[model samples]
Each structure stands twice: as C-alpha cells, then as structure tokens.
Target: MSDNVYIAVHGGAGFHERKYEKEIKHALQRACNVALSNLGSKHSSALTMVEDAISSLEDDEHLNAGYGSNLTLDGTVECDAAIMSGKSGCFGSVGAVAGVKNPIRLARAVLDHSSIPSPIGRIPPLTLVSEGARQFALSQPSSAHLVSRESLVSPQAEERWRVWKCRFASSDPSSLSGNLNDIQDTVGAVAWHESDGMAAGVSSGGLLLKYPGRIGEAAVFGAGCWAQEASDVEQGMEMACSISGTGEYIIRAMLARRLGEAFEKGAGNSDGDDPHEVLHGVLNDQFWNMRRGRGEPDPSVGVLLLTRENDGRARLWCAFTTPTMAIAYVSSKNPKAKAIILRRPQNITLGDDKPCIYITGISL
Candidate 1:
C-alpha cells in the first residue's frame, strides 16, 4: 500500500571458500545494482525487476542459474525456473529445461501466456517439465529463436561437466544426489513495487550431477517463493520471501510459506522476538535439523524476506545456516545499495565490521 519499491537477491546458500569471496561479493553487488536501477525507474515493475535481476545472475558465471548451472550425471545441462505474481496468485514454471538462455524469462512468459483467455475453454498448464518445456518455448510466437541448447552450455559448465562425470563414474552412485558441497545451490529474488505489487522468482541448475528429471523447490510454488500485500501490517500480510539452499530440505520443510506464516503469527504476539530470531529458529532449529537424524550433514538454508511496515516503510531480512550466503538489497528509501557476504548470523550486530544485512528504511 505504500509507494515504495524494494528489491533483494541471493546468489546462493552454500560452501563459499575464502578463495571465492571476492567474486561472490562482486556478483551480489552487480545483481543488486541491476535490480535497484530498474526499481528506481518509474517504468519498471516488481515482476520485471526480479526477472531482470535473476537474468543478470544467470549471465554471471560466478553464480549458478543459467550459464553457471550445474551439469547432470549424464553430462547434459538442464535448468529449472519459476515466477509468481502475488496479486493474482498466478504463476508459471519450467523444469529440466535446456537451450533457452534466461529460463526466468521463459517462466515469466509462461505466466503471461496463461493469463490470456482461450476460446475453447482451455487453460495452459502452470508447470511444464523436460522436453515438453523446451517445445513450449519454441512454440511461442517469436521470429528468432529465443535460445539454442548448445548456447546454454558455457565453457565453465562444460568443464565442470567433464570433471564431474569422471567423479561420478568412480564415486558411489548412492551418495551423489544430495551432496552440494562442491557446487553451490540456487539463486533467487523477492521484490515489491508500489505500482506493480509484489513478486518473487527463483532459478537453478539444480545440484551438480543430480539425478536427471529431479525438480527442486525452485520449481515448486510455495516452497521456493511467496508474496502477499498487507494493507495493515499488524495483521501480518505484508511479506514476500525467496530462498536459495539445498532444494530437498527446503521442499521437505516448506521454507518459504512457513516463514511467511511465522511472520504473520509473530505480528500479533506480545513477545518481543526479533525477525532474525524467528527466521533463524525456523531455518536452523526446525528445517536444518529436520534431516540430521538421517546421518547426513545438515543442509544449509538461505532466505530473503521483504516486509512493508504499517508506517510506510520497507524492510529486508536475510538469514542462512551455511558458513556464508551471498546477498544484496536496495530499497526506494535507501538508494545506496549494500552487499553482504554473510558469515555468522547469530553474532551479527549493528556496529560489527561484518554487520547483518537487515535494513529498514522509510518508504516512498
């Protein structure tokens, strides 16, 4: 209800060794700047802003989305993407899609194409996977081909594929699917525009050498992203969230929707628990540990929450269970964007050199 546009993005939530921090930081900053620049202009809506932001990440080989996407065990590239519009609850997604450059744009195109009425009382499918998804993209009314399959395979990704294929051949096949220690997870964005409402989008190459046809949380509606407009902040509808981490844990735990519900319930509680506490408790104590009994290392979860307050203000909250999560954000009220390579969330404070990325500024 406020005339403010907010944008936030995450490169991933995973093991980022010290060696890759500088490049990761630059990627986060670049993505944030692109999103903010679009959000600042009157022409851009939240949907387009997020689409553009994720596209930028896809282009950057440092992060996983399009170009840097992980390869499958069979040495092929398949990607998944989804986009949602909070106003209508209308969404579209493509999974295990190969060829198209920006899968996020294809996801948006699906959403847009579905909104048009068909004379024969038919509605387009909300989600498409595998070869079917690729056919759909090719069928769209466009003169030039939107993407080529070979173009999707970047040199970096191809090299990763060659090396991972050798590793897959020698390693135990049973232990390969869930391990993401080597390759980073998904990338995503959640945003709000005063004129265009709220939107969220997520994209991923999926875990490296994962089983073919495996669909992660990013392709699922409630697990990967969600948004709602709140006329009254006290009543709890003013939140949007996007996530990047182990797809399995996020899907099993229902991270995005559950986080939104937590924010809603926390709004009416008299207890003074902060947003960070609520987020960390849900992510670490509930979700991360949920699968620990299976004798596997606790998978990390990274999240971004965008809330519009009662007093015409917007706030962004980011949290992750990994050693570091790459994130960046900017709001209409604060034009100077800040990028954080998050390390320890529990010990973060306002004055620390590596302070938390949480920000609340007066909205336009």
Candidate 2:
C-alpha cells in the first residue's frame, strides 16, 4: 500500500547457530536498509538496487564476503559474484577475484554494461586455481585445509573457531563437491521495482578442495543471475549468466522471469491481487506443484522482494530457509521470523485494509 516496490536478499541458508547482541542485529539491518534506500533513491532501477545492496553487504567484514571472508579449506579466500538486469537482457560478472573488497560490486560493474573488460590473463583471479593446486600437491591434511591457517598469539586464550576432522573421509566420493566448508555458506539477492523491470545478483565464497577452479554461478552467464523486461520479451529481457548448479539457478530464474509475469497479471486486477501475494501464491503452491524431474533440493535459498506494479505502487518482502538452516555459523544469523520479520520496519509499514492480498484484501 505504500507503493514501494518489492525486493529480497540473503547471505546463505545453511548457517550455524550463534547469538549476537541487539546492537549487532540493528547494525546489519540498518546496513541493509542503507543499501536499499540509497539504491532506491538514486535511480529506482531494480538492477542498481540489488547490485548496490550486494556491494554494501560485501563491504561489511561480518558478512561472508570480501574482507574477513572465511579461508577456504585451502587456507585462502576466493570470492564469486554476479548481477543481472531484466529490462535490458544484459548482465556482468566476476569469479574468484581476491584483494577486491567487494566482489559483488565488481560483478555489478560487469553486469551494468556490455563487454566485460578481459583481464590480462591469470592475475589475482587465478589465486583459487593456484591455492587448490598447492593443497593437492602438498597433500595437506583435509582438516588443516578446512580452517584458517592464522596463528593466534594470546598466551592465556584458546582458539575461538573449530573445524571438523572427519570431514576428510577419503571414502566419501564427491570429487568436485570438495567444498564441504563453503558450499552451504552462501549469499543471494534479487530485486524488482516500478519504473523499471526485474534484475538479480548472487555472491558466494565457494566451496574448498584440491583443484578448485573458479566456478561461481555469478560469473557464468544466465545461471545465478538473469533479467528481462516483463513488459515485452520481443524487446528481449536481460539475464545474469549463472554456472551449472541445477537447484540454485532454476530457483532464481523462476523468481525473476515467471514471478515477474505473475506479478504483472495480479497487479492488473482491481481487486488488488498485488505482486507479493501473487509471488507467494506461485512459490508456496503452484511452483512446487509444477516441479519436474529429480534434482537436489536447494534448501539453502533466500529472497529479496522489491518491485513496483502497473498501478505505480511498490512494496518489499523477504523469505528464507528455516532458522535451523538460515543460521550462518561462520557469518551472521540475524533474521526475522521463519519467513517473516519479528520486528516491523520503522520506515516501512503495510497499509490497513490494503491487506497483503494473502493476509488481508485490497481496497477500491
């Protein structure tokens, strides 16, 4: 009812349970708000909002990105990120670039335009490749690779973090799935708005293992991120190139393309079957009903809903994995309810009688 578009975002679904102070929660939430508000104010472009949100989050050391990122099982930090724009049918991305504070912003820089400037071949981005080789060539203990090699010199204190030992079972066959550490710790964001179309971005600290090539869906075209004008496909919609990972890519694709279509239909009805309600309906019900073939369940997924309707209105909503799964053991677990926020947004409040279409009804 506030006419604010919808957007949703998340770091990772599979997280560890850790308690932080209210101030910490407020700090991160405020950070989220700042990113959203800044992008929303500047251009109102969905692409801009998602990309900048990622940039802001990546800048924060508390998050599992950029600086302070968890060392891969190989004792190094390798990052991946991507962004897609719906209206233009174009996107940009980057994979495994270290020393760069915010990998998502870099990916955003690539997505905002065309012809991502080719690197001079095998620079910092190739660190992952180099590290993985060292891990294997050295035959380093898998357990040693799982935790950071940083040495703490507090004479009276012990280490603060812990890594599992059995995590290195040779019998456990899943070669490429070597990233037992980072596979679950992830960050994903998508946004849609009025005056524009839809767009999304995903950034992750990849899983660790020997020979861990930079395989971020963010860098792969049309996998993790994608966009296209809902108003016209003939005009061609923009899409983010995503890497191969059936579950992750498909989920966002439907949210961007299909959800966009559903929102358009629901918004046209005078009864106020708004975008959120329509999206919720399709995801909670129809989408699953239509799911086909056998595929690994993508339980570690999150949403950022920010988009506008044909009537020139906007809204924001969010959903994520169950708390058991949403806990970012290595990162942060500050979230609302199971899928709803525990505290109401200070600046954002749903209008009365305008109902959420699911909880309440629309007005004339």
Candidate 3:
C-alpha cells in the first residue's frame, strides 16, 4: 500500500446558507471519514475511495445529488452521475436517471462493465440515460440499489418543489432570479492513493423545474470530473478535479478536463509554475470571459482539485465563482477530516473587467 492516501469532497459551489452551515460541514466531514475508514482494507484504492465518499454524499438530504435532489418540471426526481479512473482512463456515467438509491454506485458499475471482453466485438456504452439506465441497473448483480421513484424523493425536496412550481406558474420574473439557498449545487470528490494514483467523480440532482430528460455536466465526460497522470513524470504533476456550477457553461468549456490540461502543460504565462495562476487563467480566459462575451452576466463554478508532484508533495486546491463553497479533506497522515465553508469576502469589489473568482490551496 502507498504510504500516503488522500480524499477531498465538496458540497457544491453555490450560496450555502449560514443557517445550515453546521449540517453542510458535517455532511462533508462524514464523507471524508467514510472514505478514509476503508484504508485498513487490503483492496482499497483511489477509485473505491472516490465511489464510497460520493455515495455517502448522495445519501444526504441536505445537498443536491441523490435522495434529496431537485424535481423536474413534472415534479419527478431525476439524477446524473459520473466516475473516472486516472490509472486506466476508464469513464462511466448515467443521465436523467430515476429510481436508483445511489447513482454513484451505478456509475462505478458502468466503469467496471466496460472492462469485460466482448465476444461479439460490440462496444459498451460509457453513459446510459433514463429508462435505459434504470434497466441497466436492474441487470447488475445488486438489484437492491433500485427503488421506487417516489421513495427517493425527500419531504424537504418535495416541499421546495411545490413552492417553486407555484411561483413558476405565476410567471414571476423573481422565480427566474432563483433563491440562493435552493441553487443546483452538484456534489463531487477527488482522491489519490499510493497504489492507484488518482480518481474523481461527480453527482447532481440537476436544476429545479428543468425539463425531464435534461442532462447536466455531471453526466458528460470531461465536463464534470477529470483525472490523469503526468506524461512527463519528472517535471509534471498527477492531478484529478471535480467541478460544480452551471451545466451548460461547464460543458461547453469542459472545465474539469481543461484544468487537468493546464496543470499538465505547466504555467504558460509569467506566473512561473504557480498553480493558482493557472486556475485563474483558466477560469478567466476559458470560462468567465467566454460566458461574459456571450451576454451572461453571472457564471457560477466551483472546483476541487488534488495534485501530487514528482517530489512526493500533495496539495488540495479549491476555486469558485460563487458566494461560498463547502469542502472537507482527510489523509492518512491526518485521520480527522477538516471541513470548511469558504466564503468570498463581501468587501472585495467586482470590476467590470474582472471575474469574481476566489482561489485557495491547502497542503495535505
């Protein structure tokens, strides 16, 4: 086993309310602890840790992912999830899926299914959607993961949906403005293990009142999550990233994979190999600027990234354009997970030419 193993998770990049701060932090810390607890098992790897951690997050009703996800236009619960392995470059996802207790487990099953040799030379699917995804889940050995669609909906989510749906029908422009506390904050995780290198995964309940069958970045390859090793071992860094924000903009930019590429290419500007600069450059040039040019006044995104250098140093980085982002981290060296709700300072003025982005790094 590798001497160092680490896992980090994010609740989402959105306006996390001060009233629910304790519950949000506890949820993130619980996931970190659940992931790290498997360290004693001989079979544990980065992939499993990522899966385990996200499954825990999905079960929580407070965040928007699994059980307490947002409702569709017709008031049905649908979810999107994806997982990727840096070691093998394997990817799997499910989109607009319902009736699954844990969507991340289904995604991992898809990744595992892709490895089987096919006798008829038929290509396996990287993603499955709607009823097809549910059928595929039923075909898996653990059919117990499937549940009644209504059973997955929490009382709190149903109430939120009812209130929003009424407001939506009234044709109130304020409805379109959206409540900060009720935004679609997709949850995700990134991890690195001595033996398996790195892996990342993301899950989302999607936007409230969205049309049925709508898919978000969480279901798209290279958009929601990315994990990869450095091509040039001596000079480069192995990295994995999980992203949360507006799905359309994130999908167009392929934000997660873009960040991985930036790290692999080294800092191209005068910043001189600073990861912080690379993050700012990508968020500004690729995401923020592009969105603004297209007439988008506000674009939200939050990223949780894990990096390991050739010299055996590892760090966790969080960057977001939203008001606040909740995250937690734990490693073998420090078993106790630390959770924090990072809020952008209100005193910081946003300029017309500048993107409202905050970046911070934590040593693991």
On lDDT, the candidate that comes out on top is 3
Q: Write the per-residue lDDT of candidate 2 for residues 1-364, one digit (tens) a residue.
A: 1224444455543333345333223434543454455543546666666666666555554445554454544455666667777666666556655445556666554444353344665322211222342232234231111223232111111111113223444444453332343333355555555556666777665543323345544455544555554353222122221121223444444544455555445443532255445545645443333332234233233344444444434344443332322211100122231122222223545443221212111111
| TM of each candidate vs. truth | 0.84, 0.56, 0.96
lDDT of 1 by residue, 1-364 (tens): 1336778888877766688788877777777678776554556788888888888888788777887788777766788888888777778888888877888888887887888899999978888888787778777762113576667667877787776676677876564453445476588888888776788889998888888899988887678887766534555447778888788878888888787677666775642125666676676555755666555565667787776666656667777666677778876667566676766645554442222333322232
RMSD list, candidates in order: 5.2, 11.4, 1.9
lDDT of each: 0.73, 0.43, 0.89
What's the lDDT of the predicted structure labeled candidate 2?
0.43
Question: Relative to the unseen true structure, what is the C-alpha lDDT of residue 139 in candidate 1, on a scale of 0 to 100?
Answer: 77
Quality of model 3 by C-alpha lDDT: 0.89
Cand. 1 TM to true fold: 0.84
Span of 10 residues, lowest total lDDT, candidate 1: 353-362
Superior by TM-score: candidate 1 or candidate 3:
3
lDDT of 3 by residue, 74-158 (tens): 9998999999999999999999999998899899989889999899998989999999999998898843298899987889889
User: What lDDT is reached at residue 351 by model 3?
Assistant: 71
Q: After superposing candidate 2, which stretches have Cα over 4 Å from the reference? A: 1-8, 16-18, 21-24, 36-46, 113-162, 169-185, 188-198, 208-211, 232-298, 324-364
- On a 0 to 100 scale, what is the lDDT of residue 362 in model 1? 21
